[model samples]
Target: MLAMNYRGPYRVRAETMPDPVIEHPNDAIVKVLRSCICGSDLHLYHGLVPDTRVGTTFGHEFVGEVIEVGSTVQNLKLGDRVIVPFNVFCGTCYFCQRELYGNCHNTNPQATAVGGIYGYSHTAGGYAGGQAQFVRVPFADVGPTKIPDELLLEDAVMLTDAFPTGYQAAEMGDIREGDTVVVFGAGPVGIFAAKSAWLMGAGRVIVVDHVEYRLEFVRGFAQCETVDFKSVKDMALHIKKMTDWLGADVCIDCVGCEAAGSALQHLTGVKLKLQGGSATALHWAINSVRKGGNVSIVGVYGPTFNAVPIGNAVNKGLTLRMNQASVKRHLPRLIEHIQAGRIEPHRVISHVMPLEEVADAYHLFSSKLDGCIKTVLIPPGVTA
Candidate 1:
């Protein structure tokens, strides 16, 4: 089967790979119907993630039909369409019991520094990702969410990571009704942060980024204000002016590594103590929030230490909340919203192509094409 495989830095190709089969009795083989590139994928695309294996399949966000279920997999059966959570997890682990599936101890080895991630480092268990014709789903009963027939896979696929990550960032920031929020980075995940913040009853949302296209796109969604970081001499003032001279009540960072700064030099005042592509939008969020406020981060950082001044955050009474998405806790509700048409996340999906065109899609996504807010890979013969 042809898949998007990592060749080297800034290089992903459509190449033939071994067909997937059940590796564990609890595993299931999913015939992928739709898959999408994540902002994290860019970490490798830009040569940020170290020790990245060559020719490894490179994606985790996907929806698929169950081609075969393992002997112990009774909850999902063949022909069932489902959304696979980006984090492969066993539902019964200690972390999972606490509603934190992203840190499932079973899938992530006992001593994993960072939890397992699909197509990421071996520290992440190097599990094959969903960006292929078929994916081997570990802990199928616990990880792969069975999508209702009324729901579209393209819309729900983002639930695996992007939407859930965005929601987690906002929820962690402790957004309150009538609160004003600012989200750094206007990529897919950041856009979801804007959407989720408003859905949770935020009075105003400000999205900061240089991408005019994304800022313009945010207008289609109600109650969002956009700030082109390139145009501002003082981003803090720009945010304050939009929010009645008070800084944002809550802030979220969704574009992690890709949003690493020093790109905006015109801006004055406090800059997040960031260097190179390390601190990312999370640092910006910390700088953008009001004193005594909160900054939530869902952006994935590479394996490195960033110097965050704990004293500065403490002096201002700022709270920091961040994590990979705990999808198990939020998936059901997000899916329910999708099923109810309460959120049309599909608006972010701007491209669709056959699996054979996987390489082309990767290049387009890697380059961040004009119409490519998100690109979903539809396997052959996938209908609706």
Candidate 2:
């Protein structure tokens, strides 16, 4: 099978890999039909995430047809079309029981902070991802959901990660009716976060980013106001001025780890590998929201300290919430929204390439070239 092979920082290519087989009783072997390049995948591509071993494939958002299943896999069978969530979790664990599948304790023995994630890295349980012709899925009954007849495969693929993560970011905000919300970053997750904020009854939604194309895309896609952080002197101050000096009721950070703002942050965190990742977005969110307001973060950051404004957060009585999105937990409501035409998840896709061209797909997304917002990969032999 051909898979996206990780060589090192800024290096990935399509290479021959052995086809995956069922390794556990609950495992399933999925022949991938559609997969996507997620924003978080860039972190691994750039070597921002720790323990990302060489030769590992990197992808977590994928949908496929189940070609084979182990003895214990009862919910799925051969010929079932399914969409697998990013998280590799056991459903009966304490965190899973609470619907926090992203933090499941039974997977990823290397760390206790996060559960196993497909194709992330060794720190994420070293599980190979679906950026291949085939992938091994653990806890098949709990994680892989059969795609509904009414859903498009492209849409189902996006729901695996970006959509759910974005929706979860909004849910973490606990937005009240008529509240003013500001989202940092205009990537897929940020766009979805902004869109979901409206669904949660936010009176106004604003997206902050320095990229001109992304800002324009989010304005049309999320139907929200846009701000180019590069044009402003102080982003936090600008947000305060926009809100009549009261600041926004809620602020979200969708640009994690690789946030490009502040010379010191970029030099130390992203360049020097000193901290987990740049905390520029987190800094902006902490200082930009109204005192006693809510702040939600769905950005991917490494397990380490960031130079954040803890003193200001404590002084201003802000409510800070963050976590990896529990994709399984949000699927039902999101599916309803998609089916109802309230949210078109596939609209975010800007490019689609054959799986054999996986390397070029990565370059396009990583370089943000060709007005790319999202890119989906089609496995060999899959017509769609």
Q: How many residue pairs clash in each candidate?
A: 0, 0
Worst 10 residues of 1 by lDDT: 265-274
lDDT at residue 108 of model 2 (Cα atoms) = 83
**Which stretches in model 1 have alpha-carbon errors above 4 Å?**
110-113, 263-276
lDDT of 1 by residue, 1-384 (tens): 777778887777777889988888989998888888887887766667666788788787888889898899888989888888788777887888887777778776733545667776555777888788888888888777788777767677888888888888788989889999998877888888888898888888888888777778876753488777778877666776776676789988776655535644212111332332456466567666788898887877655556455776787689998777887689888988887777888888888887778778777876768567788887666764
Can you list the residue pairs that collide in candidate 1?
none
- Model 2 agreement with the true structure over 1-384: per-residue lDDT tens digits: 999999999889998998998789999999999999999999999988988899999899999999999999889989999989999999999999999999999998888879999999999999999999999999999998889999999899988999999999999999999999999999999999999999999999999998899999899989999998878999889999999999999999999999996788888888888888999999999999999999999999888778889999999999999998999988999999999999899999999999899889988999999999999998889897
Q: List candidate 2 stretches off by more than 4 Å.
A: none
Evaluate model 1: give its TM-score: 0.92
Each prediction's TM-score against the native? Answer: 0.92, 0.99
In order, what is each prediction's RMSD in angstroms?
3.4, 0.7
Candidate 2 clashes: the total is 0
Give the lDDT of residue 320 in candidate 1. Answer: 92
